[model samples]
Target: MTTALTLTTGQDQDGAPVLVAAGEIDMSNAERFTAALSEAITDRREPLVVDLTAVEYLDSAGLAALFHHADRIEVVTGPLLSPLLAVSGLADLTTVRTR
Candidate 1:
């Protein structure tokens, strides 16, 4: 079964779309995560910010969803997930800033 996951949407001070994700993101729940992200994507051309500050884990499937939309997304993450994103080459594909 998929582990617990939560996703919330908001806008940044600059009015850019933001997606805040919490909990583990793995194969089982990657589709849900992708759906949340897709739903949050707005018409604005500005890149979407995916805030991964509360995410505890992320697997390949989870990373793939982010990769698929790398051109339109940036990410805010924490130390726990930094290394994984780095080695997965996601950092190169999209912007990733550790918070």
Candidate 2:
């Protein structure tokens, strides 16, 4: 069975676009995540902040989706964040800010 990734979009305190991604992001749902992000960027031509605090896991396909839009994406995570990116060796490909 294919799992679905849920993405919630909203604005931050400064009114910047923010996307909250929860659940697992793997081969099963990387394409859906990418499509949602693409739609968000197309709707708002500004930098997008992605909150990964609730993400439990991420795979190579998910990392690729994030890196594909790294130029305009910012990753935010809480303390004790998952080391999915590190395991995938994509820690240098994207900006991950700890909160």
Candidate 3:
């Protein structure tokens, strides 16, 4: 079964566009994640803030989707997923803020 993923669009304290994601992000829901990323960046020039602080898991498919948008996005993640992002080399490609 597909893991539950929720995507919500909002602004950060600094008024940057933020996409808050919660739940597991695997092959089953990676497409939806990609779509959300696309929508978040539409007509926007500044880097999109992807708040994955509440996300519990992220698989290869999800990581691929993130890689596609690395140049145009910044990531905010919790401690649990910080190592994964670093190990995946995403931390080198963009700004990753751990909270």
Candidate 4:
């Protein structure tokens, strides 16, 4: 597919898992995003923090990927994505922090 998305998984200073995403996340790359997210969900108990600060664009397919695993994932967002997260009701399923 297209190289419009990038995903990386690592631990934060506190050892919490973090998934960093960048580039456009739309129908073209949603599957890639979903696969990355699925692989990142290694710990079913602990929350997975997704840093979307670098995500410049997102669409329903991309958002649905998050919703599919919203129960175990937390979101780190910004003005660009916060409103969409809230409007899509994803904010209710998990903690969404604005940055």
Q: What overall lDDT goes with each candidate model?
A: 0.92, 0.78, 0.94, 0.90
User: Any runs in candidate 1 off by more than 4 Å, and if so which?
Assistant: 1-3
Model 1, residue pairs in steric clash: none
Tens digits of per-residue lDDT for model 4 on 1-99? 444788899988988889999888999889989998888887556889999988988899999999999988999988999999999999999999999
Question: Any idea what lDDT model 2 has?
Answer: 0.78
- Candidate 2, TM-score vs. the true structure? 0.80
Better of 1 and 2 by lDDT: 1
- Comparing 1 and 4 on TM-score, the stronger one: 1
**Collision pairs in model 3:** none
Stretches off by above 4 angstroms in model 4 are 1-3
Question: Over the full model, what C-alpha lDDT does candidate 3 score relative to the true structure?
Answer: 0.94
How do the residues 1-99 of candidate 1 rate in per-residue lDDT, one tens digit apiece?
444999999999999999999999998889999998888887788999999999998988999999988888999999999999899899999999999
Q: How well is each residue in 1-99 modelled by candidate 2, as lDDT tens digits? A: 444578999889988888899888898888889998887663556688889888877778888888888888888976645465555545576677877
RMSD of 2: 2.7
Worst ten-residue run, lDDT, model 4? Answer: 1-10
Model 2 per-residue lDDT at 86:
55
